[model samples]
Structures are given as C-alpha cells and as structure tokens.
Target: MPATLNQLGLPAVIVVGAIFIVWFVAGNELMRRRGRSLAIWSKRALDPLGGRQAIQWITLHSFRLEIEGLKPPFTSGNMTGLVESWDVPITWLINRLNGRRDMVLVQLALRQQPIRGIELFRPRSLLAGDARQLAVQEGWTTEPFEEFQLAAMPGATPQRLATELLAAIGPRRADLLRLALRRRGLHLTLALNIPNRQAVQPAELTGLLQGVAAVALRYATPAEATD
Candidate 1:
C-alpha cells in the first residue's frame, strides 16, 4: 500500500507543476499581446491625422491658458490668439509623424486663422440660444458645456494660431484638451478610457490621439488681423 501511494503522489505533483508553468506563460503572453494590440489600434486611428510627429510638436510647444469669467483681458492675450500660436507646433508634429513634411508647407496656406468672437452664452446656459446653437453645430448631444466665454483679440502670430487650433479641436475633443491643459506644463496626459474599454488596445489609442493632435495643429491658425 505504501509503494502504491508514493507512485500516485509523484505523478500528481508533476501534473500540477506543468499546469502552473503553462498558466504563467500564457498570462505573460496575453499581457504582451494586449499591449501590442493597443499600439496598433492607436497608430491606425491616428494615421489620417498625422501621427507621432504631431504628438511631438504638441509635447514641445503646448501651453495652458487660464480663463476667468466671460471677459477677455486675458492675462496674456486673446484666447483666439493663443490658439493661432499652436499652429506651427501642431503642423510640425503631425507632418513629422506622417512622414509628410513636404505637405506641411502646402497645408499652411489652406489653414484658417483664429477668429475672435464674443461668447453670447455660457456653456452651462443651455437654455441660451447661442449655446444651443453651438452644441448643435458641434454635434454635442450628451455633454453639457462647462464654460462659455469669448475673446476679441486682433493680431496674427503663433499665439493666435494656437488659439484657433484649440477652438477648432475643442468641440470634438473637449475631454482630451481639458486633460492635456489641466496642468501648467509641457507634458500632456491622454485619457485612453474610450479605446481601452472598447478593447481597442493601448497602442491604437496612442496613435489615434497623436493623429488628432497633428490635424489640430495643421489646420489651426490665428485669424488674419483686420487692423
């Protein structure tokens, strides 16, 4: 009886050990696969918007603008002006990533400059006609506007272009802009929740965000000063 029990025990131990090894290996591979998937998805999504190059530009030149109330004695300049400034940075990033630096020059001419306007209604004032119109125009159906303000800066420079870029990208990517601009620094954070939840993968989200940033920079410019 003793001999028989020993034989059974040895096989059982071996089997358990083998199972553990397999599980560990599989788990590690799964993690690696997930990471790679995320990256691929991100790149594919951002391809049209200009890829890594755009992201780099935003990382280097992006700045945070703070606003108070609806008035525009902006501590620096007009919000629109600030958007304009971002143009070169945005274009540089996108074009570089897309490997289309040559296209950047041509795109520059087509880009629109920032236009200063008064905020007729606060974002929170959904009841206001202007706010509602903005919402409709931007295709914002569910989210409420957090702030509503306007600026009337009159100039054409990098700053103005940056401001215009921000405005153009704001409606579609308000959440991203908010996160990127939440702090006063060059590094920006991107929320990968949407793509992640969809099981789209980390790489994919990164690529997509990078692309969007590039496009935003490419088309953004300050309104030509009417002075």
Candidate 2:
C-alpha cells in the first residue's frame, strides 16, 4: 500500500499543478473581460452626451487595472464637463475577499465644481454590506469646486478644451465621474459648470490643472491632435 501511494504522488502533483494553471488563466481572462466590458458600457452610457467623440474620449480615458503582488486593483475615471471623479473598485474587491460585505470608497476625486449630492444605488455584491451606513458614518463629501483660467490656444473648441484637460490628468478619475453622474441622474456638464467656470485669464489652479492634463494626455494618447 505504501509503495502504491508513493507511485501516485507524482501524478497527483501534476494534476494539482494543472488545475492551478487553469484557474490562474481563467481568473486573469475573467478580469480582463470585466474591465473591457466596463469600459465599453461606460462609453455607451455617456454616448448621448457629446456624441461619438465624447464616447471615444470616455472609452479612451476610462478604466485601468493594477495588480500588486497577489491582489488586484481596479480604477475608473470620468470627466463630467470639468469635474473629474475616480472610482477605486479595488477596495470593494479587497473587502469582499476578506469577507466584508459593504460598499467601500469606490469613488473619490478632486474637482473644480461643487458636489450637489452623492447617492449610491445598486452597488455590486462585492460592495453590498453596510455601504449606506458606512457612507453616513464617515461623512463623505466630494471635493469643493475649484476655478481655473485656461487660454484657448488658437481655436480650441469646448470639446478640444475638455480633451486637453483630460489628457493632463490620466482619465481614470474622469471615467469614474461619468459613471457617478449616470448613476445619480446628474448632468455632467452642469456639475462641472464648464461654461461659467472657464476663466478668461490663466490662474495658478487652472494653469496647474491644464498643464497636468496636457502632459498626461500627451502620454496616454500621444498621436491625438490637440488645439
């Protein structure tokens, strides 16, 4: 019996190894599909706002996945006019993995517009437990509206300006803003107050934000023309 057991050990190890490989591959693929689907869905949802151009920008600037060691992290960004929001899906995922069922801080951001209000609806299962309670207990408030003055280079349209801004700051947060607005039935443009807020003369804040957006956009989508 001992001799027989020893002989089977190698085959058992091989089977276990095979199973692990399959599982890893499956998990990785699943993560990729989920990320892509999220990006597509987000883009479609925002398509009505500014047409295909808006959709394209949103899709291009949307979600990103970061895996550190064995843990996986997901972040989504969106710009509603000028207000950018970022969703960190990883916190919820991590909490779920640890057996906590509650909506974590899935979205956070710094914006140049006032957050009228925030409401979390139909949170995913991973973010299901005590989200409302947690939000209330923590007294979460969106960042205050900031003012920026950007110089319109030559003939920069509103869309061009928006695109330039997004380029400066990696689109992950901007995409999250888009998702938040959709979920809350809010208008992205109104939230950011783009028209009224764009100052004629450049200021420290606007200059900084625009500069950052310019650099980031160049890095993320270098070939895209800008005004």
Candidate 3:
C-alpha cells in the first residue's frame, strides 16, 4: 500500500461512514414527516366524498392512500403518490433534472356509468404512449385538443364531450395527465409536485369530481343520440 493512502485510510473511512449514516437517517425522517402531511391532506381531500374508510402506507419513494364509501356516482378512490425519492440522493437528483416532479395516480370507481369509454390525456405525460395505444386497440376515435389527446368510443360518446370534460376540470386542467371514463368508473392522473406538498382542499376536489360526473350524466344518451 502507498504510504500516503495507508496513513489516512481508517479515519477517513470512519468519517465518511458517519456522514452516510447521518444522511440516511435525516432523509428517512424527512420522508416520514412528508408522509404524515400527505396523509392529513388526503383525508381532507376525501372527506367531502363521505370517505368513511381509509388506509395509508409510507415507503422509501412513495405513498399509497385509499379510501372508500364515497357519495353517489363514486364508490371509492385510491391514490398512489411518488414523491419521496429524496431518500436516495442519486434518484432525487435524476428526477429533478428530468423535470420529473412527484405525481399521483388517482383511481376512482363509480356506482354507475355515463358512457361506455373515453380518455383524455396531456400529450407530454409519460403515460401518453400507453394511453394512445390502448385507445387504438379499443377502437376509439382519437383527436387533438390543444395540448391534449382526446379519445372516445366511436358511437358511444358525443363530440362535445371533450369540451365539457375539460371545462369540468377547470383551471387545473394543465396538471392533469390523464382522465378516463372506464366501464367501472373514472381514473384521473395528476401532477402534484409544482405546488410542492400544498394542502389540497376537500371542497375543490369534490367539486372537480362532481363536475365531471355531471358532464358524464349529461351525455348519457343512446348511441344514435350522438349522431
């Protein structure tokens, strides 16, 4: 071994190890705090929907939240949030550099259906490719909507449906990655990083969901009605 390397090795290693330990612990604590805040925020966001039961979990890089017992049209909702990558410095750096902020996968089940199928997506979202492919395979007609891609079951949905749905989303439309009307219910994917842990209002979310449901109901007509 070289004299200079051997001379300082053990002490240097100990110091480096201590720093790593501190970093890991601090990162974990930060994640825990964020998780708690999110849990509270989620409860508030779901309360108006009569969310009677809820479950939450915290992990190294994500938070999972689910709630049930919603009001009419919605039976349940679940959110899968990817927001705590800070526990791993490398991953955190990469995510930030890519302009990839945290996001939530929101799945909502409805008690009824307004239309057979529909999909709206922000074309720049990471999930855009998959949504597009699914639309094609399902034989849905696709069209452009400013910065979004809109698709609907050819004979099952109205041409004005897209306009109404976007209007329902209101000013927050830009943050939406995808809005789908499936056989069972609706799925909304939203980006939650920009406002960085900002508390979401229950009334606001409730309103958004209700507005979309209202539009869906308005378009629930026979296939020939769309023609």
Candidate 4:
C-alpha cells in the first residue's frame, strides 16, 4: 500500500470505506433518476452484494422483494426490494438509520373496495414519519390503544378492529403500521423484523406471509365486488 495511506491507517480506511459505501448505495439508480428511485436503488444494490455474501457464507440469508400489484399483462409500475436479513452489522446500521425501528421486510397491499371502513393503527410516535393525515382531514377519529393509536373513518370501529387485528397478528412480533383508505378498503402494512445469523427457512417466511394475509383479508372485499 502507499506509504501515506499506511501512515493514516484506520482513519484512511474509514474515509475510503465511507466513500465506497456512498457510491455503492447510490449506484446507477440515483445518477440516472431522481426522487424515490434512489430509495429503490439502495435495495437493488443490496441484492447482488448480499447474494454474494450469502454464497460466501458472510451473511445468513438474502431475499428479493418484488411488488407486482397488477396481475394482468400490463407491467406499468413494478418495484423490487433486496434485503439481507440476519447480518448483524448491516441490521444494526439499518436500524440506526431508520430511527431505531426494527429492520424488517415490510409488505404492503392496497385494495380497491372498501370493506367496512377505514381502520388505522400506528404507534404513539412513528419513527418512519407522521401518521397519514389524509383520513384525518376527511373525518377520522383517533382512538388510543395501550401501545398504539388507531384512527378509523367516522363509521368504522377502531377499538374493535384493533382487537381483532391483534388477535390475528399474535404476540411477540415487531412493529406494525395499519391504515384505512377511501373506497380502497383496509390496506395492510405488515413486516417481520427478526434477523439472525442463520439461514431463513422458506417455510418460515411463507408462514409469516400467510399469517399476515389472513389478518389483512378479514377486511378485504371480494374481487367481484371490487371490480
């Protein structure tokens, strides 16, 4: 190595590492586009690197999260997320960056039909951002829970729905974000925050998705009715 760099030692390494991380995190996504694409880009950057880490056994597991809302031929707006779960160092960095919220694979689904009414549940103070104000403007009431605050449309019952949702989600889980929509029914935002230094079984992730879906569907309207 260069004598100057060698003399700098750890400080030089830190500087070089920071620069490399920024470039890698930005990748082609940021330079090529603007706004949200950069966020998506970060996920993309994680993919191959995390995959490589997995192959080399540097990380426990990796997965690709792709969003395909439209079932038909039209491929208008699709997005993907790449995550390396169970990497202690990466997980710690991510949590610190995301306001200490447990890092997890957040999966969201929005439907067209309004099941009963809006049912929203959020923490007393969200680390992500402020709770959505759209519903509140249109006349939703906020009901406080033991650890979370729920906001539902005027006619909707927040307290009761929260009970049902909690019962469905079970205990010993990570953070959650629940909200309602206009005619869009009860949208869902569920995640699995557990990360460990071991391979994640496919069946395990499958079961988690299934459990989340079960809770979400309770407020979902039939497809025919939605159409």
Q: List TM-score per model, in order.
A: 0.30, 0.32, 0.71, 0.47
* Candidate 4 C-alpha error for residue 151, in Å: 1.2
lDDT of 4: 0.42
- Candidate with better lDDT, 1 vs 3: 3
> What are the RMSD figures for all models against the true structure?
17.4, 18.5, 5.3, 10.7
lDDT of 2 by residue, 1-227 (tens): 99999999999999988876776566555545544544443334333322222222223223422111211010123322111111234543564454332111222122222122232222332222343444354454322122221221123242343444444434222211211211122112111111111232223223333344333333231232449
- 1-227 per-residue lDDT for model 3 (tens digits): 69889889988999988887787788888867766666666566667878675565657546677777788766777876665456667776776664455566667776655655677887766567878897887788888867778887665344577777788888777567777766544443333332355544646665777787777666554323233
CA lDDT of each prediction against the hidden true structure: 0.32, 0.31, 0.67, 0.42
Candidate with maximal lDDT:
3
Cα lDDT of model 4 by residue, 66-140, tens digit: 443322111112222223222244654664565343233333344433364444445532322334465456566
Model 2 ranges off by over 4 Å: 51-124, 129-227
Q: Candidate 1's residue-wise lDDT over 61-125, tens digit each? A: 22222222211111111111011111343553563453221100001111232222211222332
The model with the greater TM-score, 2 or 4, is 4
C-alpha RMSD (angstroms) for model 3: 5.3
Number of the top-ranking candidate, with TM-score as the measure: 3
Task: Single out the weakest 10-residue window by summed lDDT for candidate 2.
Answer: 66-75
Instruction: Please report the TM-score between candidate 4 and the true structure.
Output: 0.47
User: Among all windows of ten consecutive residues in candidate 4, which has the lowest summed lDDT?
Assistant: 49-58
Rank candidates by lDDT, best first: 3, 4, 1, 2
Candidate 2 yields a Cα-based lDDT of 0.31
